[model samples]
Target: MSALLELRNVSRSFGGIHAIRNVSLTLQPGQIVGLIGPNGAGKSTLVNIITGVHPATSGTIVHKGERIDRLKPFQISARGIARTFQVVQPFPSMTVIQNVMAGAMFAANIRSMDEARSVAMEHLTFTGLAAMADRPAEQLTLANRKRLELAKSLAMNPHILMLDEVNAGLNTSEVEQALDLIRAIAARGISIVIIEHLLKVVTGLCSRIIVLHHGELIADDPAADVIKDPRVIEAYLGSKFAQRQMVRHG
Candidate 1:
């Protein structure tokens, strides 16, 4: 099967500083991939580049065989690439379902309000936010806000979903709930690239793991192999700790 998305030697810079350097990777259809790194490893920058929030300074981004590096964010969303931000920002004044309806109208091209509402309700129900559909977005708890973010993204009819720290602020039980919802999403055949700091979450949920360090791609391997890699260990831990791990394992 063809790749769902491809980034070839992709790099991004802000004036004198390079945020991402020559990172190349591919997302296969129906796969859940973990993107992990220490803080300032450029994980969010890479996501921005993919979703067109920040275009790559050099390299190509291809989705379904078509180049999209230069496309605007809305254009990319319309082409079925959707992302949720690390910081959930909903239209505070809008009702829960109305916020999702905007995504349907904007990205899914649903013009009629009735049809948009139908699509939004389906996504809200799927995300377990149906009971809160009429509530104002600002009134939600942190967990529910995250669910709202997911519902809005799903209403976009995405083929690929890039989640940036979707489980960041949740408690353990809430995180578990989010994991189940994510699994259900992947079951529907939407490819997922989840950026997470929680190693257990990544290892348990993703088939593959990609690690980045200091703006470079250091490791791309199966989840089990990645966690054991010395380079990955050093990136997250320290060089001294990584050496101890290597010697102990050997």
Candidate 2:
């Protein structure tokens, strides 16, 4: 399968500090790829560059064989790319259904509001938000907020779903819910790039994982290999990632 999203030699800098340096990755249809690293690892920077939230200082972004490096954020969204923020921002005043209506609007540009609502409704139902459709976004718990974010992104009908730390502050059960939700999302045929520090999620969901440290990709391999990479070990998780390894087997 061909890549639905591709980054070629992409680099960005802020205040003379290289945030991301010559980073490149690909997402194929129906695949789940993980981006994992320590804090300030340029994961978000790369995500911003791809989603057009931050322009690349150099290099190219290609989606569906078309160059989209110069596209604006909305343009990028329109081109079959959608993302969830590490911090979700729902239209708090709006009902759950209404917040989803915003994503439905993406399809509405080429369709109709009625059609969009119908579609958005389906996404909400798919993401387990149907029962709360009448509730305000602000009224949701953290896990539901994460689910709502997933619903919102899905509402755009994106072919590629980019999730930024969707499992940050939840209980074990909540995290499992998130993990299951992501599996269902990918099962629905959307490719995904999950940027997470949660090793369990990465190991569980992604077939492949990329490790980055200090703005550089230090490891890109099968999820298993990436987890065991010594350089990756020293770079991000310190002695703990490896120690965890020993405990898992020992």
- Highest lDDT: give the candidate number: 1
lDDT of each: 0.95, 0.87
For model 1, how many clashes? 0
Off by over 4 Å in 2: 107-111, 243-250
RMSD of 2: 1.8
Query: What tens-digit string does per-residue lDDT give for candidate 2 at 76-148?
Result: 9987789999998899999998888888786436367687778778988988889999999999998899899
Per-residue lDDT of model 1, residues 1-250, tens digit only: 8888999999999999999999999999999999999999999999999999999999999999999999999999999999999999999999999999999999998999999999999999999999999999999999999999999999999989999999998999999999999999999999999999998999999999999999999999999899788789878857876777678887
Model 2 CA lDDT for position 27: 75
Candidate 2 TM-score, C-alpha based: 0.94
After the best TM-score superposition of candidate 1, give how far the Cα of residue 229 lies from its true spot, in angstroms. 1.0
